[model samples]
Target: MTASTLMIQGTSSGAGKTTLVTALCRILSDEGYKVAPFKSQNMSSYSYVGEKFEISRAQAIQAIAARTEITPMINPILLKPLGNYNSHVFVKGISYGKMHAQDYYKKFALYKGLTESKNSLDHLLQTNDIVILEGAGSPAEINLQQYDIANMKMAEYCKAPVILVTDIDKGGSFASIVGTLTLLEKRHQKFIKGFVINKFRGDVTILYPSYSVLKKKTGKPVFGTIPLIDFDIPDEDSLHSNPKQISWSTKYLNVLDKEINHLSKIVEKNLDMKKIRGLLH
Candidate 1:
């Protein structure tokens, strides 16, 4: 039987999609469910080689959260951008050589990347009790929607229930969330299970009134509001990282175990886990 899927999509890049997915993987694992983390395509300079295949370091980190071994299936397509519109693409952890952006989208992604991703996801669905999917960037990128295997298209392929997350640290969180939904076709919109407001600092009660207003507008509930974290978490993408922050020990994999557990506890306390689990089919 296929496992249940819960997809984490962001209002935009750096919106905490990876953080939520990582936390949930640990949470589910602690609950004694066999879980796996998956991202169809990841564009990152951070890479990890596990089981003799290279994949995005983010998925590898989430696999640790899940207490599972890393595999290429967890992140099948990795694109390390080279200069001048070209990216070094890796398919199933094997180098596919460098290709221009246009060719990657028009030829590789449209013709082959989606199929490869589906196959990997199918394997995980069959093997795990549940799979946590993390999406890249916003699903509402209209110009790239046609070749988007990382967001709505992937969610549709797996019939995964989506939880849209946004960073409250960024102003206009509500607008970004609502606008994202507004831009998507209704068919894609239906897959979203709810929204999560991340990196919040003030009293959560102060946000309650807004949640109701959001529900009134989008017909979706605010599933959670996560507080801004104090510690440094080596997240999937570095776009949002503080450039001046000191970095050191995360290089050693064991160092993240404590942080992962800490993250899980915080998310479990703040998030409506029962409702989130209910989203699984």
Candidate 2:
């Protein structure tokens, strides 16, 4: 099957992009599509080792959801921030050495990192039926757009339709969506086919009015609002002790496992699966 790509970019970090990608992967996989989760560049300390290289824990969860094997190519560029404004750069799962912020931006982006990322993406597209690309941070960061390989730039490179996600629980959900659209160039904005408001609690009826205005303002459909789930999943970045450390061997994890399974059903029902299928085309 030919791979169609959809890139999930959030209004901000921790806006449920990872979870949505996981759910979308599972939904697509369950529907009989061979899917893979991709992130061109990821900055995370909590990671896992694969057969060939290391990848973020979030990517591993997404691969599980998609029922696909994990590969270093799924996350070609990894920047693990090591305190004191330095990060360890990994290109295609191998260490490229530690670098200061300025040096990394100047030396790597133009020289080799971007090329490696594009190659990895091309490989995934060739192999998968659908590629669910999860963008790092907000794509609307105009200052970083020129150097960005993980957000809109990656979406543009892959020719993927994008779904902008924002956290309603953080408040200013409307502002986040509109602000992101307003900040983006028209071409980049055009890539955003839909919007997703995540972590919304209470009746959705109250958001009807706002949703209407948002659609009118951005000329994009609100895909669906995802309610907050209490279960702990592997977060990309959090101050709390790593969820990756918790072994599934514990009795408590057995109950958590069932809840996580139930979560996929919730995701399938709440999201507009039909629309999602249409968008991929």
Candidate 3:
């Protein structure tokens, strides 16, 4: 069988998608799976060492999680979009020079070559049991949605299952998760196996109500609510640096539980609480 892929995405930017993907890479690796990580396109200033070509720092982090060396093929297209519609594209981690948005669109055929390159690399790395794919920013941005070579489009290309991840700290995370589920085309939504609520604070008991509501609203399983981890992971987005700023507090747990219970009364439920408990453990 071919390696399975899980695409981690979020409702908006700075939703901790990258960090969670990296963590999952680490978790799966610990389980003795030969894992690899891939991102169709990444926009970051950080760089990583590669045997034949350079790789994105984000992929490098995942590589570290997998205890493997960085490979350029893991991140095929690296777009550094400065102001304007122009961005620098990297093919196989080597600078392919720059192109304006219009120029790039005009030459969209070139992306197929990059995609093929990634497929060839995946074939060569047949030792991997799983390949975790990371999606770009919110897949809901309609303006850029069609031109999207990442996220859902990338999943379609690679034929991978998707795991939509949203940040609960963002207040409207429920809406964002539901909106993303509803807005995606049928094909894309079919590939989505479950949803994860990230950056959760307070007690899990308190969060269960909202989780149940979201599950009922979207008809998707709540894979887990990743509590705010204090690891010093680098921030890929231009957001707050300290994750510790929004962790569970003893005083707030009771109120949070009450709120969740109240919400649960109004919405339906369909989450595997046992699986969620396993994730926490």
Candidate 4:
């Protein structure tokens, strides 16, 4: 049976996309669904080497949350930026050499990137009951829009319903959400199921009055608000220069499991998982 898909996209980079996907993976996995995490392309320095190759450490952690083995199939493209607009690339865990940013996006992204990601995503969809996709960054980047194989393009590929999230702690959550929606192509905008406000620290009900206003302005409801949580999970954004990698030692694995469970509980309580699950259908 073909699997249903739900994607988590953010208004901007570093807006809690990775953590949210991790939370959702555990949430669904706990309910007995065969869940898997997919990200079309990831630019990270930290990765977990599998049997043959390695993938982003964030995806590796997410696989554990789903109770599955971390495989390169989940993250088809891995880029390690080597400075001066150059990045070392890996495809399906094998090194594909390096390319400058200009050539990489202009040529490789169009010719090879799409095909590899499509095949990998197809495999996950066909074998799993559900696939939780995480976007690389905001889909509204006008400069990268044409060559964007990561955000809306990937979301469209799997026909995944998108939940756009923004960090409220950034102080422009409202405008960021509205601006992102405005920038997306009308067709892509229609693919969005709703929005989620992330990193909220203050009273949640204080933000209630604007919920309807947001719905009226953008024609999408605020699915939920995730409070600012001090979670100690391995972070892809912070792991760039991090010397500490995830240890598969049983002792470390147990701690990681507890962190995942803690995060999933908070997300399940605040985020409208019931409504988000409806998007899969």
Candidate 5:
């Protein structure tokens, strides 16, 4: 049986996309589904597995979610740009070495062979369950939109349904979600099964009206508004990398407060204070 895949994309980066995908992978695996995570092309300096295996640290975290060993096939064709249009390409976790964007595009067909190889690797791993694919930044980049093997095109390739995620904490989340849906090609919209509003704070009741409007506008189901969680997962995006250095804006401070309060209640009931205090310090 072919493996069913789902692409979790965001309005933009740092929209809690990686966290949601990891949580879903864990939840599904707990429900007895054999799952794997895939990313078409990842461009991050904070990588795991080094120059040997070109996958992102985020994909490695997904491997952990699946309770499986990390493999390069899960994230093939990683590009680490070192200024200019030049970048170092890693194929299956090993450095295939560096090339400029124009040069790479000119020889782009060669990467298709790599993608096919990765697909073959995925086929070997599929034991009749699911594979969750995470997409790169906004699928709206008009310039790079055509060469989007990371988000929409990857979903089309794998025949996976897409679940677009937008961060409400970003203020224009409703517009971002609706606009993304509207901007997608008619064919791509068909694969967009649902949309999610993430990192919501305060009463979810208050957000229902906004959510309703978005649903009506896009004609897509709102999966659920995911409350912001305080759990410390590794940062995959630079935006959230330096938590200590970056003070939360007033808006996000409220989001953090709500998340902290929620977690405190849970910890008060289930966790030992002394043990938790040690980790906190």
Candidate 6:
């Protein structure tokens, strides 16, 4: 059976896209659905060397969350920045050599890689009950819109419902969400199923007015508000530069259990998963 798909695109990097994807993967796995995670292209310094090739460590962690083996197909193209804005690109777990930013963007590299990414996604859809796609960054970057394989283009290709996630902690969450929606093509806007306010702290009730206004303005429901969870999870780049964050403490373990459980409950209580499921219907 062909799998149902969902794509999560954030307003910015570190908007909690990876964490939410990981949580959703675990939740779906717990519910007995065969779930897999996919990100067409990732630019990260931190990577996982799989059986044959290396992929982003974030995707590797996501696979674990889904109870699956690490595979480079999940992250088809990895761009490891090598300073001076140059990147050593890896395609399908094989090194494709290094190139400067202008050279990489100006050539056929992105398009060529899209073919492999699409093939990998097709393989994933055929093998799983559901595929959760995580886009690299905001879809609103008009400069990169045409060449985008990670955001709305990929969502359209998969016919997946999109969840626009914005980090409220970063402030201007409203403007970010609204501006992003405004910038998307009319057709792309229609693909959005809901908005997710992530990395939030303080009293959510205080923001109820803004939330209502956002829903009214965008004509999309607020999916949920995920609080600022200070649990240790490996982010793609942070995993390498800040190895200290990876350590686990029994003291922190109790906190992690409490926070994760609360986060799951928040997802269950605040987000309309039934509505999300209905998007595929």
Residues 229-260, candidate 6: write the lDDT tens digits. 76656666633465434324567645654555
- Give per-model TM-scores: 0.95, 0.93, 0.79, 0.97, 0.80, 0.90
lDDT of 5 by residue, 204-268 (tens): 78977876787677777677667766674557655755533223256654554344344434323
lDDT of every predicted structure (CA atoms): 0.89, 0.83, 0.67, 0.90, 0.69, 0.81
Q: Give the TM-score of candidate 6.
A: 0.90
- Root-mean-square deviation of candidate 5: 9.4
Worst 10 residues of 5 by lDDT: 272-281
In model 3, residue pairs whose N, Cα or C atoms come closer than 3 Å (at least 3 residues apart or on different chains), thus clashing, are none
lDDT of 1 by residue, 1-281 (tens): 79999999999899999889999999999999999999999988778765667788788889989999788889989998787989899998988899999999999996789999999999999999999999999999999988899998889988999999999898899999999999999999999979999999989999999999999999999999999986545765459443323223457556688889888899999999999989988
Positional deviation of residue 93's Cα in model 1 after best superposition, in angstroms: 0.7
- Candidate 3 achieves a global lDDT of 0.67
Q: Please list the residue runs of candidate 3 whose C-alpha ends up more than 4 Å from where it truly belongs after superposition.
A: 113-121, 238-281
lDDT of 5 at 28: 59
Which regions of candidate 1 are displaced past 4 Å? Answer: 238-251
Best candidate, TM-score: 4
Off by over 4 Å in 4: 238-244
* Tens digits of per-residue lDDT for model 2, 1-281: 45899989999988988888988887888889999999988888877676668877778778877888888888888889998879998888888899887887788875687899889989999999999999988888888877878888788887899999899998998998999889998889889999888998999889889888987887899888888887667677753454446443457545544555667778777778788788795
Error of 2 at 233 (Å): 1.6
Q: List the candidate numbers ranked by TM-score, top first.
A: 4, 1, 2, 6, 5, 3
Question: RMSD of each candidate?
Answer: 2.2, 2.2, 9.3, 1.4, 9.4, 3.3
Off by over 4 Å in 5: 50-52, 109-128, 240-281
